[model samples]
Target: MLHDLGGLLFIALGLVLVAAGFVWQGGALRPLSTKRAQAAAMRDRSRNLLRSADMAIAEARRRAARDEPAIVTVEDVTRVACRHYGHLFVEREEAAAALRQRYEAADCRVDCMTDAFN
Candidate 1:
């Protein structure tokens, strides 16, 4: 009878240990799940920004090819900056200044009058 009782106690102890291990593993994975969610959000945002930038550039190219005036706007400047630098985390003034410089230097615009006609 004592031997049988000891076997039952050992089995109970094993079950408890297994349950504890599962709980610990679940706790460890919670933070990983959060990180994955944040990463997915970031990836989605990047895709959207890239899509917008591509569309803007395409439109500009179309206009330039047609020998039409393509006025670059603030949004266009930001999109260009995002295309090159991912997302701007700089101060408003600094980012604006930097993006303005990038926009000015970019050959994104062709000489429509010369290139398209000639």
Candidate 2:
């Protein structure tokens, strides 16, 4: 009977340790999941900015084709993106910087360093 009791006590301790290990693992994974979510959000923001800049470029091209005084310049991509996604940025400078990066990638004529908006 004593031997049986000893075995049961060992089993109980083993089970407790296993449960603790699971809890620790769960805690560790939580931060990883949070970081993944943050990265996903950042990617989505970048995609949206790029799409907006592309659309602005296309609109400018269409106007030039029609010989209509181009209402939107390549530099205006930043302004257009900011108008749509302004809330995503913490500051005007941040919005300008992000939009300008996207605009340059989309082949805007103005250099990122010189263009105030694009």
Candidate 3:
């Protein structure tokens, strides 16, 4: 009788361990998926920013070539760059806001602490 009880206890303990493992894995996987999605999104955003910057530079060069003004100043290039960057900033802000909303919904943390540090 005692042997049978020991076997039953062992079986119960094994079942509990298996259940705990599944629960732990499920919890861990949720965060990993969120992180992977965030990373992919960030990469896509960076690629878009780079493409926009390249196009803006090309357009500026084309404009300058066509205009052929008497004086081509650094300010001219800077003005065009600022305009390009401003548009990019607006788009990036919108994307970031959307991501933040998603993260909040998932109960995940968004690391915007850099703004505070700066």
Candidate 4:
């Protein structure tokens, strides 16, 4: 009877440990999932910016090569690029600024130079 009780106790302990592990894993995964979603959003924003830039550059090149009185300049290209991608750029900048403000408010230090380098 004592041996049976000991075996039951071990099983219960094991089950408790397994449950605790799952709970811990769930808690840890939530933050990771959130970070992943943020990262995906950032990637999508960047892709949109690049696509807009590409379209603007192509349009500018086409305009420049055309036989027209108005020749497209570098400034015109830049303006067009900004106009095309302005929304995405502004959103990304806003998100970054908000993140920076939150980090500063929390007294968390960020490597700004490293971010600029990237």
Superposed on all Cα atoms, the candidates' RMSDs to the truth, in angstroms, are: 9.9, 8.4, 16.3, 14.4
Of the candidates numbered 2 and 4, which has the greater TM-score value?
2
Please report the TM-score between candidate 2 and the true structure: 0.42
The backbone clash count of each candidate, in order, is 0, 0, 0, 0
Model 4 lDDT tens row, 1-118: 9999999999999999999998787564435587899999788765654454344334544555344332223333235436765652344343334333333443333211112111
Superior candidate under TM-score, 1 versus 3: 1
For model 2, residues 1-118, the per-residue Cα lDDT tens digits are: 9999999999999999999988787564435587899999888777766676567656666656443433444346556666776733434464456556655675555422234363
How many pairs of residues collide in model 1? Answer: 0
Task: Please give, for residues 1-118, the per-residue lDDT of candidate 3 as tens digits.
Answer: 9999999999999999999998787564435587899999777755544444344334544555443522222233334434655533434343344333433443332221111111
Quote the positional error of residue 43 for candidate 1 in Å: 1.3
Segments of candidate 3 deviating more than 4 angstroms = 1-32, 66-118
Q: Candidate 4 has which clashing residue pairs, if any?
A: none
Q: Is candidate 1 or candidate 3 better by lDDT?
A: 1
Q: Report every candidate's CA lDDT.
A: 0.53, 0.61, 0.46, 0.48
Top-lDDT structure, candidate number: 2
Winning candidate number (TM-score): 2
Q: Give the TM-score of candidate 3.
A: 0.32
Cα lDDT of model 1 by residue, 13-87, tens digit: 999999998878756443558789999977775555445444554556566635566554446635554675566
Stretches off by above 4 angstroms in model 4 are 1-32, 65-118
